[model samples]
Target: MHPKLVEFLAGCRDEAPLQLGVLPFGMICGIASLAAGMPAWLAQLASAIVFSGAAQLVIVQMLAVGSGAAPIGLTAGLLGVRHVLYSVSLADYVRHLPRRWRLLLAYLLTDEAYAIAILRYQAQTAAVHQSVPGTPPGNTAPGATGDAEGSPVRDLRHWYFFGCGLTLWLTWQVSTAIGIVFGATIPADWDIDFAVPLTFIALLTLLIRERANQAAAAVAALGALLLAALPYNLGLVGAIILGLMAGALSTRLARRTRLAREASQ
Candidate 1:
């Protein structure tokens, strides 16, 4: 088989395990959308329109409560702003691609795809650096014009990304469809809704590996508790902003402290 197809299949294969968590997560969203009184067609349409599980839940919750559009817009923007950061972090690896390639890959990008694709790209960088003659151990600054761009591995890497993303997208769509069709028949006592928070809590545990993340999460929880009475779900918005600021501030402080220790030594 061609290398491009190989890479593509590699991405799909790697993303398979993560779909275990995703299946139930998507089902919860579909069931919630229906419970919120959305039409079946509209609820399924939302899986495509607002792809993020968290964002969809927030939007559907607001709609269920009869909130105004202004708050919904703000909340959605905040959720999407994280994607900009994800794209920027991955931009250096994809810089040489045509605009069409970049745009299509950008749509496929997601939290799971990104986590897998980045590690693959980094491993490529390391592999090339080691295999090439006279390359420095630390010289991984391989942009479009660099040594990595000329290699076959570089050519096929994006296909892997596409594969991973497309698989998740397909799984999400199918899971949502199943939930929508059999939602009413499912027993109420199954307590499947508990999976909603459990899934995110598992994800949150993976993310909070440092003081900065801990700080951000703590502030966000406190902010939400304090501002819970705010109308139009503005309290959640404030909590998000405060959490971001706290994380940023903590990161800067940690960097400065490390720099100071190095200077003294």
Candidate 2:
């Protein structure tokens, strides 16, 4: 077996649950799109090509509500803004590669893929930094050079990321096809509505592990509820923007406060 395959398998074992969780949601998006009267092929294509769960759900929901294509396009655009950030972050690691390779990397840069890649990248980076002189013990700066023996390990991380992306892509395609085929057979009263809220609540709870993130989440929730009446689902857009701004501002403030305390000491 290739060294990277072993590392990829190890990393994937730890991510099994999250991988399963994402599949059902992606399938649900497919079912929802079909239920919303989307063409079967369209739903399947969206799941195959777009591969973003939240954005796909939002698009299908809008379509179900008789919303215009423009709004759906806009929603997808707004949700996809996160990809730009991911690309920039990943650039530091793969920037030296050929432009053709970069294009392939960009296509595979979904949320799950990015998470796995970034974690492996950070781990390799920290290992490298630890080997360097004058660097902190735990600093994980990208581009930090690992020892000669560690080069194989670092090289292996890329294959790990590729495997993760490929696995997710296959799962998404299979689950989506199933959803499109059997969506109408599922009953509406199956009590699946709770899943969405529960998933988000779980996500929110995780994000609230820090005081600043907690405060920002609270503020954003309020802003979203207050603006919930906006038409064309612009309220959703407003809520996201407000929430992001609140989180950013609060996090900056918290950092400043911490710095001030250190200075005072």
Considering summed lDDT, which 10 consecutive residues are worst modelled in model 2?
136-145
- So what's the TM-score on candidate 1? 0.76
Off by over 4 Å in 1: 122-155, 201-239
Question: Any residue pairs clashing in model 2, and if so which?
Answer: none
RMSD of 2: 4.1
Taken over the whole model, the C-alpha lDDT of each candidate is 0.79, 0.69
Worst 10 residues of 1 by lDDT: 137-146
List, residue by residue over 140-252, the lDDT tens digit for candidate 2.
Answer: 34323357664522333555556667777777788788778876676878754455556456446544666766776787788779988986556766776777678778889
lDDT of 1 by residue, 1-265 (tens): 7767887899999888778778877888898899889999999999987788878888888999997899888887777776886798788677767999999898888888887777777666778677785654234333212354565324557788899999999988888887898877878898776765665565567667779989998999899899999865567778878988999999999999999999999
